[model samples]
Target: MYIITDQLKENGFSVNRLDQIIKRNNNKRQFNTLEYFCIYIIMENIGLIVENTSYNITAGNIVFLGPQKSIEFGKAKGQDTFIISFSSSFYERSIKDSLFLNSQLFFNYNSDIFIAPFSNIEEMRVVFMDRMENFRKKDKSLYLSAAHNAIERLILDAFLHIPTEEVKKDIKFDYLYCVNKFKVVLQRDYKTAKKVSHYAGELNVTPRKLTEMTEYVLGKSAKHVIIEKLISESKKMLSYTNYTISQIAFELGFSDEGNFTNFFKKHTQKNPSEMR
Candidate 1:
């Protein structure tokens, strides 16, 4: 796939066509967990596995994937699928932007992937094409900002068109809002602050109320959410990095390696080294 923007940078945006990526890997199914968020626009029927769940995607469909979700793409030859990806640091330049990214439109704690149909496929394609052109201009003044605006437009458009039925009608909006905010805070502080009370303090709510809100919206307790985040990050590190178990434990804010090991094995039924 042709990358419209540089991929070597720490924080950046990129646009890629899926055909070349699949072909480059010998047309075999590819599995990955990206460190950044992604929006996939499908121009043909294809299969995708997100978080181990299979989905058959058709033409005119758009898929959103948050960071650290495992994804497997099925083979598709000559399909006009395109992906737009960006890092949190690249997109969340302000509090408003951060909250927007954490909104249900992009980040849903109960689900790692969100799929919707794009009724105006041609118009969406035009916007993506223009964005690719803008990102190609590395020397242009405010080129990155232009790219940001384009992506924001795409996200906002998706937000406006998301199917109402996808959301649970029984849940109250306040609980949904609180859970969304809790997710944002949990993601930001999971490395240093793993306690539910700490997260409640951050959101200016009682720990009991926070747990109730999380249960109401995500069908899990607030503490469960924190543990899930920890396990997810731990697996990524073990599978992708060369860090020793002790080092990883320290990095994740555990008091000691033994405690980390016990915790990991208790939850995942495997040692960190075995996972690696």
Candidate 2:
């Protein structure tokens, strides 16, 4: 709901060296509720802290962040990066698929696959520079086609490198695909749909197959993914809202306040009251 696309209306795209962007915005309030898909390719070593996790950014490592995620600049010196940002509107216009964000390349906020290392750092720098120049030109109509292709190439590059089992025998591309689809489905139905079979029915796969796919690709079962997603939302509500525990329990589809507290404590190892 936080529309960051407003700053990108100049060309529906924005590219900047990370140091410059950081220097220009030196305010203490640095956490962003971004509304655009953003890619940050580290040109130098840096540490990126996001919520409860921190990523060690080295040269050639690119971080892909989806909209609505919170991020913070970690304590580091001489950090350099090339950042490319574009609105979902721009992405849909160019790609012709409004639901493209459902893909594993875009979402899956729970996974460590957000960062991937690329060998051709210099070549990528050239590619990003060329795209930036396209945004600068006045008559940019001609650049649209070229820019679209370039963006797709970059996106494809990121998708191809998502971490999977190294043993080719264990790598089932269909399972991977199904797991990603399951992620999208879980995001849409996690609140109302609790059973593994419920999601398996939606994906047209058996509950066992879905669990295997999730374990293989994400090191967790389908039920674990659902519970994690629900608990994540519960924590957000607990931290940000004035809703009472009973109200939150009812909203989250819990049978009762005690049941919600037990479920929360089982996963988080702390009661909801302690969290608040």
Residues 117-185 of candidate 2: C-alpha lDDT, one tens digit per residue: 788877877777765575547456655545556666666677677555422344566776577667656
Per-model TM-score on C-alpha atoms:
0.60, 0.60
lDDT of 1 at 257: 96
Most lDDT-accurate candidate: 1
lDDT of each: 0.74, 0.69
Clashing pairs in 1: none
Cα displacement (Å) at residue 66, model 2: 0.9
Could you give me the TM-score of model 2 versus the true structure? 0.60
- Residue 98 of model 1 has an lDDT of 64
